[model samples]
Target: MKRNPVRVTRAAGDIGAQLSAWRRMQSLTAVQVAERANISRDTLRRLEHGDPGVSWGTVLAVARALGALDRVVDALDPFQTDLGRARAAAALPKRVRQ
Candidate 1:
């Protein structure tokens, strides 16, 4: 199935908003986070606004700086199923078909 890029962008924006909220909750200013992540304040602002152009590495760095990397990783998973070996085996075609 085709994925919607717009939806992904919106999701990223939502995540960025949440990150900003969390940062505010911790009383850390944008400058502080930017400095800690070794990124520019402008870049950090763009990240907080959910700009789609922000690099994943930069996002990770900001998350790490805020002590929120684990939370971010936990939130961004698209596949978390536990199908196991049985499921994989069942998906294969029959020997005759192969």
Candidate 2:
């Protein structure tokens, strides 16, 4: 009964799969990753299974444990894409007054 948009669900699944692939590529077991991320094995399993309810902190912790934190952070850089760059160059609203 999750109410996430289809795109969000798909993105979660992709990210989960990629994390699993990274763990396998590094020869790290689930227990090792869970310990390294300082999270419970159940949490890691839920994250790896693409549960969108996983916390952002948990995602960042897992990424850091897997040495992919930089990549994850960089992927959010607005200046990295043409559209983002263009948007950045344009004047944007500072804040909306309620």
Candidate 3:
């Protein structure tokens, strides 16, 4: 199946909006967050606007500055639940012996 690039772009924009909203809620300016994250203000602006060309490390730095690194870790954590393990195991095809 083919995926829609436009839909992916929209999702990225939504993520950027959420990040901007979170930063605003914390009473921090883009410059402040960018400086603390050691990123350029323009880079931060592009990220906030979902430019899609930003690097993963830049995003990670911004997230860390926003005190959202824990949430990112939680989202990627593999051992949080037994159900995930079961699902992963079930997805593997059984091996056959000669």
Whole-model Cα lDDT of every candidate shown, in order: 0.85, 0.92, 0.87
Q: How many clashes does the backbone of model 3 have?
A: 0
Shift in Å, residue 8, candidate 3: 2.3
- Ten residues in sequence with the least summed lDDT for candidate 2: 88-97
The list of candidate 3 runs beyond 4 A from truth reads 1-4, 78-83, 88-98
Predicted candidate 1 versus true structure: per-residue lDDT over 1-98, tens digit per residue? 55559988897899789879888999999999999999999998998898878899999999999999987787655343355446656876667653
Candidate 2, 69: how far from true, in Å? 0.4
TM-score for predicted model 2 compared with the true structure? 0.86
Q: Candidate 2, residues 1-98: lDDT per residue as tens digits?
A: 64999999888888988998999999999999999999999999988989889999999999999999999999999889999978976857767689
Candidate ordering by lDDT (highest first): 2, 3, 1
Clashing pairs in 2: none
The stretch of ten residues in a row with the least summed lDDT in candidate 3 is: 1-10
Give all candidate RMSDs, comma-separated.
6.4, 4.7, 5.6
Off by over 4 Å in 1: 1-4, 76-98
Q: Who is ahead in lDDT, 1 or 3?
A: 3
**TM-score order of candidates, best first?**
2, 3, 1
